[model samples]
Target: MAGEEFEYEYLYKALAKYANEHQYPLAQQAYEGAGAAEKIHAAILKEAANVKTYEGTTVYVCPICGYVMAGDSIPERCPVCGGPERQYEKF
Candidate 1:
């Protein structure tokens, strides 16, 4: 999971750089979405390792975008896509 997180981070940075250099707004937005998801994944891994547990938890992922939230409930709106909470699917 940590390795995956680093991969995502690398992808996010590379995409962001390319987007900026090419003035691709869509790609820039995708970088933001990817970054958000990667941060959440990294945090989840760190927390699980610290507590030595991974039970009775939920991870919500926005279908419209890659926004990820770990908790019992989803956010009111996806920070990246502005998708409604109901749009999030459990992962």
Candidate 2:
């Protein structure tokens, strides 16, 4: 999962650069936001790698930015793009 997150992080960062060069501000923002989250995810996944047990862990995804959150609960809004709680998908 950490590897995947890192990979996606690279992709998102590249896309953000491309979008910015192409003058697509919205796309650039989305990509940058997601990229930031992916980096965070990589670290989080690394920390969780040694854990063998699982519990009532909830997952939330910000639809607008592709930001992911995994834990007992998610924040009221996405820290990167500020996506509201109602806009996040739960799993």
Name the candidate that leads on TM-score: 1
> Which residue pairs does candidate 1 place in steric collision?
none
User: What TM-score would each prediction reach against the true structure?
Assistant: 0.74, 0.65
Model 2 TM-score relative to the real fold: 0.65
The whole-model C-alpha lDDT of candidate 2 against the native structure comes to 0.80
Q: Cα lDDT of all candidates, in order?
A: 0.78, 0.80
lDDT of 1 by residue, 1-91 (tens): 7675875778788888899899998888888777777777777777777886657778788888766688785669988779998788886
The top-ranked prediction according to lDDT is 2
Model 2 lDDT, residue 41, Cα: 73
